[model samples]
Target chain A: MEKKDGCVKPSKGVIQTEETKSAAEPVQNGKETQKMLAKVGKPAPDFELSAFFEGGFKNVRLSDHKGKWIVVCFYPGDFTFV
Target chain B: MGVEVVAISTDSRFSHKIWQEEELSKMVDGGVPFPLLSDAGGRVGTVYGVYDEDAGVDIRGRFIIDPDFNIRAMEVLTPEVGRNVSELIRQVKAFQHVVETGEVTPSGWQPGKPTLTPGPDLAGKVWKEWKPEMAFD
Candidate 1:
């Protein structure tokens, strides 16, 4: 969503977990999948990820970004590798 | 033509805040253009196929989704390589142009350049109508 200053801000959340080992899998139609998707022609799996925005936390859903192009980037560590 | 950029990492929101404050202070406005997502559980990272389980970190995975939520473009890369923002911007512009005008942008297409109208007649004659000299930088 665009902020009052006209700059589009990102939404994020924070929830630490003990588990770290998992495989990447493809998501089913509209369902969350842990695997990598096969191709880029299908609809993206719907998901809600918590985001950090404006010094606060909120839930950001993929479906909420409909009607506008969305760029989802997954990067490595924030402090170490980023 | 509105586009939103979201990034996910295996760091907590607290870490994101630190990066924004300490390291990313030189950003355009003192922070990233978009929000840095906190994929604390590694759920989003794993789903997008960028996480390295052995390192407890993610590789570089980028996806461009159209307005209808279609996966228009995606690139999964190793952490050693970084993404190119200029190329990504070009692609977003190209995709939006097609969605709006129903015309396909040829290779090396930038804004305000020539576009090709896909049709049966143009099937094997794209080079005839579009010459490389006609391209706009």
Candidate 2:
């Protein structure tokens, strides 16, 4: 079932357990996997981080975008995938 | 596309700089129009709850913030999957339309399409008027 915010719970078959960890392996679906969290309509947690922008090294703070829409996307690592 | 897209990764600034200069620059030269932010310390990822503490990195997490800075949408994918950039853009456009017109878009709703007016019976109203092609059910 999907939550009010459009997130669907993984089917029972998709949930992995510790017992399955060692003896079993995730079936490859020939698709890329992603990890995500945060419910829509909820307050986004604030944070301060360093960024390499065109200008120079700078502190990027979530609160800094107070009046603007921010698309914060997290990738597993940099330069690994394009 | 006036929306700002920021990509965060746990890689260090030096590595980020090298990648941007060596690789990302090619995309910028080829018309990639957004900025990539380096989350060297993983602080941003941690706060966003996408952090993989054991791996010392973040999982795929996408958040759409409104003009007022409230989170309007959030999607977390498993680490092996990547996000759909086009869908993100579409969602931004749909959100912009809703913010401007005060109308709500149904599932898979796109621009220039009919949007439902909000009321006490919003879900049912939306469902009743929803096109079968647009809905999962």
Considering only chain B, report the TM-score of each candidate against the true chain B.
0.89, 0.83
Displacement of residue A7 (Cα, Å) in model 1 is: 30
Residue A80 in model 1: shift from native, Å?
4.3
Kindly report, for each predicted structure in the order presented, the TM-score of its chain A compared with the true chain A: 0.53, 0.49
Poorly placed runs, candidate 2 (over 4 Å):
A1-38, B30-33, B120-128
lDDT of 1 by residue, A1-82 (tens): 5454312334442222222113333356877345554258777766666566666656677768888899988888776543
Candidate 2 local lDDT, residue A14: 17
Worst 10 residues of 2 chain A by lDDT: A5-14
Error of 2 at A22 (Å): 38
lDDT of 1 at B53: 84
Q: lDDT, candidate 1, residue A78?
A: 77
DockQ, all models: 0.47, 0.28
lDDT of candidate 2 over A1-82, digit per residue (tens)? 4233212211121122343233333346974232322357755555555566773455566666777778888888877763
Worst 10-residue stretch by lDDT in candidate 2 chain B?
Answer: B30-39
Q: TM per model?
A: 0.78, 0.72
Where model 1 places Cα greater than 4 Å from the true spot, the runs are: A1-33, A80-82, B132-137
